[model samples]
Target chain A: AQSVTQPDIHITVSEGASLELRCNYSYGATPYLFWYVQSPGQGLQLLLKYFSGDTLVQGIKGFEAEFKRSQSSFNLRKPSVHWSDAAEYFCAVGGANAGGTSYGKLTFGQGTILTVHP
Target chain B: DTAVSQTPKYLVTQMGNDKSIKCEQNLGHDTMYWYKQDSKKFLKIMFSYNNKELIINETVPNRFSPKSPDKAHLNLHINSLELGDSAVYFCASSHPQVRGGYTFGSGTRLTVV
Candidate 1:
């Protein structure tokens, strides 16, 4: 079973400050990692995804994530935080072996609430 | 046009009542999924259909049923709703070629009073 763990429950950062959200996963094989953002009264939106190749993957809104296999982690980072970036972030993991199909469903973490202070 | 759209953005109903949430995707993706987000903001996969065929069915209650008339549509029907069922339900679509990235709908908030 593939599971994602987002240790940070809530993070408060001032605007223009660096931000990082830690995400750890437990998977036997190479896992498919993803970071999703959910704004107020909105559905989850894909921030970035790591399938294979290039350990570092860049996503929309100046967001990027690094996949470290040894650490079993994929942490999202941004050089400078913006007020619009304040939202709930979720880390999800999935794999071909998850549901006996390549399109295996994702298992998301509890989510980390990000608060940006201006 | 929205890639994925679910009808009845907000649904408020009494307990023991049955309701259904309709979803349609214009992206023409072969696979569609239903996810539930609880009050604690935990997102969980409930059901998934590939080209109108049942592929992945999680350990959800039997009362919750999913119907996919076609590859572009997947509707969720809940029977005898309970307080625990009050949450936002999201519909998503994706292709097998695309690994783990799913395009989600705006979500339908279901409230059971």
Candidate 2:
């Protein structure tokens, strides 16, 4: 079974400070990792995803995540934090099945609440 | 235009009453899914349909049912709603073969009073 674990339940960072949200996963094979953001009273937006190849992947809103296969981790990072960047973040893992039928069946973590201080 | 849209962004109904939430995706994706976000902000997949066929069904109650009239539409109907049913339901779509990111709708907040 595939699962995702986001250790940090909540993280507070000052404006212009660097931010990093930790994420770890357990999968049978090459895992498909994704990071999503949800603003207040809004649906989730895809921040970034890592399928294969490069470990460091860039996403929208100046967000980036690095996939470490040895560590079984895909942590999201940002050079500077902004007040508008405050939102809930989720880390999800998907199986790399042969027929691609396991695409939408993602196992998400409990989510981490990001608070950006002004 | 919205790539994925869900009707009734806010729904309030009394317990024991039945209601339905409709979803539509115009991104030409072959698979659509329904996910429930509890009050604690924990998200879990409830069901998924591929090409109007049931592909993934989680350990959800039978009171919850899903219907896909076509490849572009997937609706969820709840029977005898209860207080525990109050949560945010999100509709999302993605193309599996393409291995791209999934697009999500604004979500429907169902308040079971």
Candidate 3:
């Protein structure tokens, strides 16, 4: 089975400060990684996804994540944080199967709560 | 035009009661999924349907049943709900073959008293 772990339970950063959230996954094959953000009482919105390509993938709202196969990590980062960026973030890993039916099934990590200060 | 939408943004009911949540997608995607977000905000896949056929059924309790009337709609029905079943349920749609990311609904918060 595949699983995802997010080391940080909560992170607080001041506006204009850099931020990074850690994520690690355990999967056998090439895994599809994704980052999602969820505000209070709202559904998750996709931040970015990595199937196979450049190690650094850019996403919406000026967020990016790097896929490090050696460390089994896909860490999300932002050069500067904004107050509106405060929300719960989740990292997910998708298993690959021959039939392509497993692509939509995502195993998500325990979310990390991000708090941006003024 | 909402890409994906789920009805009943909040559902509060007593234990042992039955309830259903409806989901619909307008993005013409062929795959739809149901996910549960617990109190701690941990998300887990519960079930998936592709082209109106069941594809992935996680190790969820049998009390939780999913029905897809067509490719565009998937409804979740829980029988004899328990307090443990209280959580936010999300519906999402994606094109599996195209490697596109999922478009998620606003979510339905179910609270069993």
Candidate 2 lDDT by residue in tens digits, B1-113: 99999999999999999999999999999999999999999999999898999988999999999999998999999999999999999999988642586789999999999
In candidate 3, which residue ranges exceed 4 Å CA deviation?
A: A98-103
Docking class of 2: medium
- Decreasing DockQ order of the candidates: 2, 1, 3
Q: Tens digits of per-residue lDDT for model 3 on A16-106?
A: 9999999999987788899999998888999999999899999999999999999999999999999999999999888566655464778
Candidate 2 wrongly placed segments (more than 4 Å): A98-103
| Candidate 3: Cα lDDT at A106 | 81
TM for chain B in all models? 0.97, 0.97, 0.98
List candidate 1 segments past 4 Å from native.
Answer: A98-100, B97-100
Report, to 2 decimal places, the DockQ of model 2.
Answer: 0.67
Instruction: Rank the models by TM-score, top first.
Output: 2, 1, 3
Residues B18-45, candidate 3, lDDT per residue (tens digit)? 9999999999999999999888888888
Of candidate 2 chain A, the 10-residue stretch with the lowest lDDT total is: A95-104
How many residue pairs clash (N, CA or C atoms closer than 3 angstroms) in each of the candidate models, in the order given?
Answer: 0, 0, 0
